[model samples]
Target: MTQLTTDAARAVPTLSDEQWRGLLEVRATDPGAVARAYAARRRPDPLLSRKESLFLVAADHPARGALTASGDAMAMADRRSLLARMIAALENPEVDGILGSPDVVEELLLLGALEGKVVIGSMNRGGLDGATWTMDDRFTGYDADSISESGLEGGKMLLRIDDRDPSTAGTIEACAQAVTDLAERGLMAMVEPLPYHREDDGRLTLLKDSRSLARAITIASALGTTSSHTWLKMPACDDPDTVYASTTLPCVVLGGVPGPDPAADLHSWGRALVQPTVRGLVIGRALLYPPDGDVRSAVAAAAAVMRAAHPGAPAA
Candidate 1:
């Protein structure tokens, strides 16, 4: 087996027949390559620079059966394309790390793209999008022990609370346990709490109002035995000030389904970034599959917004 290097210049290449074949060869012959790569990975130390913020690229949506981006329903259905886009986005120096499920994280580890990057493990992915039981999110992906053993920096769990659904209680309980477990291991516990209401047709619809989101934030912040190492991942809402006032825990904005206008989305994120508690961004589809299909440009534009929002601040 060929050993992978950590040189950023030669880390990841365009998805091609040769690249695919190589990855398959390793998986077929030496299934332990994934573990080997992870064990030998050059991890990023000190996670963040002095007072610098986080900028993680999220790719855990597909694991939850949510792949639409900018109106393209199956835009991320192709694994090769998705990995290629992730590589392109991570190639930029501004990107501090990645947040993904076990499979995606291991693949990037084998590709040597995660070297010197803050790797965040996605914990709950059993709640498939558009499913009848979407509120019963389970810890089906990486757990705190696995995250620690794999040299990951943090664990992220999705908490969707539906007022009308009883399954939401199970999700809340599981998220609280995950937070406690990760915190006990001295790893960052990132919680994404979103409020939802069931419609007459039985579909769950997210409530973006400041009050609802603010309530969700308070609930998530109080989870676990302690909030010492917990972080919040939230949407860049219209009333960021009011919504963010719920907690002092560090917060990162998630770029939900991109709107028709990309500039408007960036503007909204810029406004949210100015909030003292809003640390940075953990965007996915919007940056990975932009309307113009330029992954590099989209990522650069987002980094520019973060830089502008914190002028004179050192890069994380």
Candidate 2:
């Protein structure tokens, strides 16, 4: 399967004020258009590029009240700007798909930006960003039936495990069930598992040690009745080789909080992409709200890394 070429990859695209207003108007009066738009949208074929991997743009942060990016507390608060940035990334042919909540995905569908692009519906966004019950992540987004009915390629869920937080057990159980549900439908179930520990100041911190990550990977890998259609979304780490060795399930590197250097981010993802279990990238703020505020350039940079990284053999 040849990748989408430059000639096929479109130039920089636009989302004018008029089109923005039209979306608002439809939202105000005709809500059913959302469903119709999704049903009518054309789906992608041979979803992955020739590399047998994906480069998905993620926009599921806002749905969970995580509006901060690149030092701006309200960076992703503006829907119009967010949608425009997503379009900028999608126009580049190297971008294979997107992992977003229902609202963002529907907006892209209505805007006609998602045609022929893989779409992964975001699930389990009920845990508000900073709430005390953050560990009680609930499935407030697309379910398996809805994802399949919506013609999406798959559904994604976040799993945060904390020893002190008993709520983690519930979240784990829910994700396991979701994994089973998606597999039953013969659809992809993307599970992002991360270990967490609360600080004395009560800050929920992600545990980034290789051991912690490896443990999380094993747990997520074993979820559901079947692992046949499961994919793990892993955070960039210093020891991907050691961490990824914990599971045979296919994995995609996710861009966590953006750092000051985008090159560093790319280096990490590029390294992981070469790993047999690591398939591709599902990046969000790092590309959408890049330090330089150039979405296309950021996307192109990641795409360049994908081409240079030499992905491992096709995933089993």
Please name the candidate that would achieve the greatest TM-score relative to the true structure.
1
User: What TM-scores do the predictions have?
Assistant: 0.94, 0.93
lDDT of 2 at 78: 81
lDDT of 1 by residue, 212-265 (tens): 999999999999999999999999888998998889999999998888788999
| lDDT (CA) per prediction | 0.88, 0.89
* Deviating ranges (above 4 Å) for candidate 1: 1-13
Number of clashing pairs per prediction, in order: 0, 0
lDDT of 2 by residue, 2-30 (tens): 13345433432347989899999999999
Q: State the lDDT at 301 in candidate 1.
A: 99
Which pairs, if any, clash in model 2? Answer: none
